[model samples]
Target: MTALPQYERLEAPAIWREGPLAQRREVIVVFGDATLMIADGRSARALTHWSLPAMVRRNPGKRPAIYAPSEEEGEEVEIDDPVMIGAIEKVHAVLEARRPHPGRLRGWLGGGAAAAALALAVFWLPGALIAQAARVAPEAKRVEIGQQVLGELTKLTGQPCASRAGTRALTALAERIAGPSAIAVLPEGLKGARLLPGKLVVIGRETVEGPDTPEVAAGEIIAASLGAAQEDPLLRLLRYEGARAAFWLLTTGDLPETALAGYGEEVLANPAPPPADEPLLAAFAAAGVSSTPYAFARDPSGESVLGLIEADPFKGQPAPRPVLEDAQWVALQGICSD
Candidate 1:
C-alpha cells in the first residue's frame, strides 16, 4: 500500500452497523496502517479495524457511500463525508495499479496464436511437455489454476466454510504443518485431505469436527502436503487428463470442463494413500505433533496403520507444543456452522 501523506491520520464521522440487524451507532473513523480504524465516538475507544484492500463500497455514485470489509461480511459503514470517501477511493486506485494482471503477467498463459505456435515448436512427448508445464508454472498461474479447480470441486462439495475466527484458527494450524500452505475445509463430498496445486490443501468437515483434538487433523494436512512434495498436484491432474488437457491449459489458461467432468467425484472416491512412513513421521515430527492419534484415526484397531502407531515420533512423550489452544479448537470445529 502506498502511503498518502496528505491523508495521514485523516479522521471523519460515520455511522456503523456492527451486524445486519444491529442498531446503527455514531462512530469516529481514521486511517491507520493500511486499515480503516473504527472507534466508539462517545468514548473514543477502538471498536474494530478493517483491512483497506478488503474494503468494498456497497453503494457507488451515491450521496452516502456505504462500505463494508467484504462482500460477505455483514457489517457496514455509512460514509457521507466527501473528503474521507475521496481519500479511500484514491488509496484503492493506487493499490489497484500495483496489483498484477491475471493471465497476462506470466507463465504458460499467453496471447492467443503466439502461445499455440510456441507449443507446436516444442517437440517433446506429450507426457514430457505436461511435466515441463507443471514444473515451470509460476505461483500466480498455479494459484489461478487451483482456484478454478476449486470452483469445479464446489459443485460437488459446496462452498468451503469461512467463518472469520474459524478461518484464522485453520490458517494457524495449516501453517504449523506446512509452511504457508492453505487448508480449505469443505462441508461435504471430500473424503480426506486433498492437496491441490498452489499449496492448497482441501479437507472434509470430519477432520475438524470429528477429532477431539487438532493433532489428528493437523496430521491429515501434514500427510497430504507430504504426498504433494513427491508428486506435484498440478502434474497429477495433467497426468490424469493427458496431453490435450495440458496443451490447452498451457495455451489458453484453462482446464477443459470435459476433462474435469466427474473429476471431483473421482477424487472423493480415491483418496491418495498416506505418504511413506519415513516422510510422514518426519513431517509429523517437524510439526511437533504426534503420529499416533492420526494412526488411530486411520485405523481404530491399529491393524492397518500399526507402523504409524508403534513408530510414533513423540511416543510416550507429550507434544513439544500444543496443536491448538482450547478456544482455537472450538472455533475450528464450528468453521462450517455458518
Candidate 2:
C-alpha cells in the first residue's frame, strides 16, 4: 500500500480570539508539501488561493481568525470547528517562528553580491581586459613592432655562442646574486616576460645567456622589477587602454594584441628603470655583488651614478657566495634545450 503524504489534518484551537467581544472562529490546518494549509472548519469559507508561504507572517502573534474573500467588498465568514481551530493555531505558531527577517536576509544577499562585484572590478577585470586587447593586435604586429626593436641588440659586440650551458651558468650566478627575492627576468624576445600577480619573475633565454656574470643579470632584473612595483603595471595598462577596454578584459580573458607589441619593443630599447640608491645598495649588499656594474650599465657617465658609487657598500667585502656548482650550472642551461 502507498504511504500517505507527510502531513496531518487537524482542528485549529480557539487562539484566534481577540478584542473585547467574544468573536469566535473555527479553522482547519494541514501540514505537508513544504507548507501549512489552512481552511474554514466547515470547508464553507476556504481560501483556495492563499499562499501557505505568505501565512508565516501570522505565526508570532495570537492565532488569527480564518477569513475568506467574499463577493461583497469587505466581508469574511467566521469558521467554527474545534479540530480545525486547534490545527490552525499550531500552523500559525510554526510559521511565525520560522519566518525569516526580510531586512537581515536582504542585507546579507546584497552584501555578498557587492563584494563579488568589487573583487571582479579590482583584481579580475584588468588582466582580462589586457588579454582581450592582446587579441586585437595582429600576429604580424608582434613580429614587426616587437621583433624589430630587439633586432637592434644584434649591434652589441657579444659572442654568437648559443650554448645552453652558458645560459645555465649565468642563471646560477644570477640566482646567487638575487638570493630569495630574485625574480627571473628573460629578454623580451625569448620570454614574453609576463609579470604575473604577486611579482613573480619570468625569465627568458636572453637573460640567462646574454651576460656572463649572474650579478649583472640579477641586478638588471631587480632594477626592472622594482620599477614595475613602483609604477604598478596593471594601473599603467588600464590608463593606456581606457575604462571601457579594461571592462571588456575583466569579463573576458584576452587583450588587444597591439597593446604589448610596440610597448615591448620600446621597453627593450629603453634602459631598465634606475634603482633607488638606498634600496639598490641594500640589494647589492645582500646579493654580495658590487653595485658599480649595474650603475655603470645604466649610466656610463659617472656623474649620473654618483649615489651607487658613493655608497659602494661592498668597498672591501668579499664577493657573493656561489649559487651552484659548475656541473649544476651546465645542467640548468641544458634544461631549455631538452
Candidate 3:
C-alpha cells in the first residue's frame, strides 16, 4: 500500500462481521492510505477495504469500539484494540481540520483585493481592513470574542436574566425564530436587540415586556439575525477598534482588552439601526412571523417603520401561528422578574 502523508501505517487484530447475522471472523485490520484494509487472519489475503471518511462509529463510548461504513448499513467491525481506535479518531480529526472554510478563503481574497486597491485611495482602507479580519476569523475565535463582548455587556446590564422555566421558554422561542442560538434577556443596557458573533442575540427587557404577543419579541430576534447576516458583527467590532486593531486581529486572531472595554457602553447608548426592509420582510416571511407587531412595538404610530408595517408578510393571514405557546410566552415575558 502507498504511504499516506501525516498518517502512520498501523495494523491490529479485530472481529469483523459482514452483516448482523454473519458469523464473526478474526481479521487483521490495516490502516492504509485513506482506507481501512481488512485481511484474513491466517491466510493474509485482503478481504475488503473501507473508505476512512465514510467509516462511522456504531456505538460510541462503549467497551468494545464498533464501527460501520454507514449508519443505515448493517456491516460492522468490532475492535477492542485501543491503538487502532485511537489511530482512526486521530485521522478523522486531521481530515476535519483540513476541510475548506469558504468564509476564511473569501476573507483572504477580499484582503488581497483591498491591499491592491490601496494605492488608488486611502479612504476605503478601514472598511476593507475590518471586513477582511471578520471574514478570515475562524468560528472558534469568533465565539471567544463574542463571549468577551457578552461579559463586558454583563457589567453594564448585570448577568442575563435567568430562571429555570424562563430560560427554557427563552431557548424554545429562540430556536423557533433564530435556529440554534443563544438569546439573552438583559435587565438593562440594550434598548431593543443586537446580534453578536457566535450566534448570541441580546435583547432588552422592554422588548419582551412591552409587546402583547411573543411575535414582537420573535420579530426583534429575526431582525437581529438578519442584520448580523448582512453585516458581520466582528467587522463592526474591528472597525470600533480601528485599523491597528484590525491588523492585529488578522495576524493573531486576538483583540486587545482595552479596545473592547468601552464597546458595551457604546452599544447600549446607541440604538440598533434598523435592518433593510426587503430582507427583514423576507426573514419574517421565512420564519412565518408577522412584521406588523414588531413594527408597531418599535413605533406605536408606525410612522418610522412604515415600510415594515406596509409590507407585513403575515398581515392578511386570518391566524398566523403563535411564536410560542401561551404558557411559554408567559414565562418568557416574566424572565426579568425577580
Output the lDDT of residue 314, model 2.
Answer: 67
Question: What is candidate 3's CA lDDT for residue 192?
Answer: 80
Instruction: Give the Cα error of residue 149 in candidate 3, in Å.
Output: 0.7
- Candidate 1 clashes between residue pairs 3 or more apart in a chain or in different chains: none
lDDT of the structure predicted as candidate 1: 0.78
Residue pairs in candidate 3 whose N, alpha carbon or C atoms collide under 3 angstroms: none
lDDT of 1 by residue, 197-237 (tens): 88888889988989898988888888888887788888887
CA lDDT, every model vs. true structure: 0.78, 0.45, 0.77
Candidate 1: residue 144 Cα off by (Å): 1.3
Better of 1 and 3 by lDDT: 1
Model 3, 1-338: lDDT tens digits are: 12234323456788999988999999998877768899999998999999887789977888589988777777888888664786577555545545565767766666654554342123223455566778889988888888888888999999999888889998888878854378999998678888888878899998888788988888888888887766778877776776546656876678755668888887777645788899899988888899999998888898999999888887788335778889898888898994
lDDT of 2: 0.45
The per-candidate count of clashes, in order, stands at 0, 37, 0
- Error of model 3, residue 194, in angstroms: 0.8
**Winning candidate number (TM-score):** 1
lDDT of candidate model 3 versus the reference:
0.77
Report the lDDT tens digits of candidate 2 across residue range 79-99: 443323333344444444444
Q: Which candidate wins on lDDT?
A: 1
